[model samples]
Target: MPPYKEGRERMKRKHSVWMMILVALMAVSLIGCGTTQSNLENKDTAKPAGKITIGFSVSTLNNPFFVTLKDGADKAAKAAGADLVVVDAGDNTAKQISDIEDLIQKKVSVLLINPTDSAAVVSAVESANKANIPVITVDRASNGGKVVSHIASDNVKGGSMAADYILKTLGDKGNIVELQGIAGTSAARDRGQGFHNVVDGKAGVKVVASQPADFDRAKGLKVMENILQGNKNIQAVFAHNDEMALGALSAIQAAGKNNILVVGFDATDDAVKAVKDGKMAATVAQKPDLIGKTALETALKVAKGEKVAASIPVELQLITK
Candidate 1:
């Protein structure tokens, strides 16, 4: 063989080997780039791992009952290492709807609503539903929405208990004035119905006057005063909530009537104190804190794809002195 031909063969072999090495390096670089791009796409589409957020749209923080409820939710969220974003509606139905919309925009994993007005909050609930957000109603329920769960006491039973207390105390012979809560609310409607169920049929128990005080303490006093002007022979008063009952008590005390029994609902701190002091007759106990805690636990279960009951009822009892 010729020396020149051998040298040419060696150079060709070296060139081929270098070309192969370059091609392998380029393939490695392309594979690395593809992996990074795929990760970026996944990150953009899905949430970060182990992040769960819950939104709570409360009716009003001003009311002590609702304030306690919020505190319970906050406590549970902290215990579970979850995030809770709360918005207060101040008892305004429109504000509550707007608040819920904002929560949906935030893309919360779950939504908890304590509706100010059961009928008016339907649209807000439907909006959450359309967003594919699960909704759990606390304390108060929406009249026309698909709710994942509703957590509240049996208002009708509470009302019936109130009426029974009155009848038993007065021997079913008394002229009673009812100071009602806000009209159209489930609590108001159910409580009033329960009261009527027991009182309407009694021969001697008469509902001489029943008026709505909007669940305001001051309004309760004013309305009772007006009722007193016309019905001076009233023997008992039933207020839908503690606020109104306390108000009516004030009016009754001012009117120098000490024998009239006053029954109320929602045994709040104030109402309980009143009952202890014998200032008020009786009030139904609805544990708002338990309701809040149960609601949070249910939301966690639901967010994790667990099934929960459609209605969760907390225990209720009558508080009397």
Candidate 2:
């Protein structure tokens, strides 16, 4: 072979080796990118932190008892570093259901309900159950659905206490009138039953007139007015709650019906004052504020997936002048 041909062949071989080295480097770079990308894809993704919010559906704020209850719940929620949303139903069952639905939509951590009517609020409770939100009853209870817990006083016993006091003060024989609460609430039913159990027919002590005042002071006054017209010989009046009791007291005062001892439930501020002023015979003291506070605390525990008791009871007492 010629010397020029041999030198050209050696240069050609050198160029091929350099090209192979470049291709290998390119392949390694591509592999490095793929491995980096795979590592990123497999890594756990971080998510935004979420805040816990609670929703409360109150029966009516017009009444002092429920108002105090709401205040307690509000204070509790604020201390826990959680948001509290409260809705008022104005003692309207339909509105309460709507309020619960809205709360569900808001994705509240817990749903609290002060039902206007026990039976009517079932579907609302069921709706919360469907959403997997825990429900805790305040002041009043629901007739149906799965509730996380119920916190209330023994209404029946409270009712019995009222009746016993009335009868004892009346000397166990007098014409008594019973002022009922909202018709379908557990408080109404239990309280009425308790009164009846004690004074149904004991020593001729009788309930001369029994009517529902819907737990409103204005309605209570009107109902008492109507009852006063027909039952001239009535000696005492028993109202289911302080609102109704206070109403009846107004009517009794307005009618100039003297010596007719008036008693009420729920020792609301007004009722207690009435008793102190020597107008009302008594009012049942249901610590609504404590009930409200306990409810919020239980809800927080539930939010933490902690187990809680099925029922919680608050203290009940009778206040009299």
Model number with the top TM-score: 1
Model 2, runs deviating above 4 Å: 1-50
Q: How accurate is candidate 2 locally (lDDT)?
A: 0.91
For each candidate in the order shown, give its overall lDDT on alpha carbons: 0.92, 0.91
- Per residue, candidate 1 scores C-alpha lDDT tens digits across 212-276 of 99888999999999999999899899998988999999999999998899998888899999999
* lDDT by residue (tens digit), candidate 2, 1-321: 899999999999999999999999999999999999888876745323555678999999999999999999999988987778999999989999999999999889999889999999999999999999999887789999999999898899999999999888988999999999999999999999999999976877878899999999999999999998998999999999999988899999999986999988889999999999999999989988888899898888888889989998888998987
Q: Which residue pairs in model 2 clash with each other? A: none
lDDT of 1: 0.92
Q: After superposition, how far is residue 130 of candidate 2 from its true place, in Å?
A: 0.9
Highest lDDT: give the candidate number.
1
Worst 10 residues of 1 by lDDT: 43-52
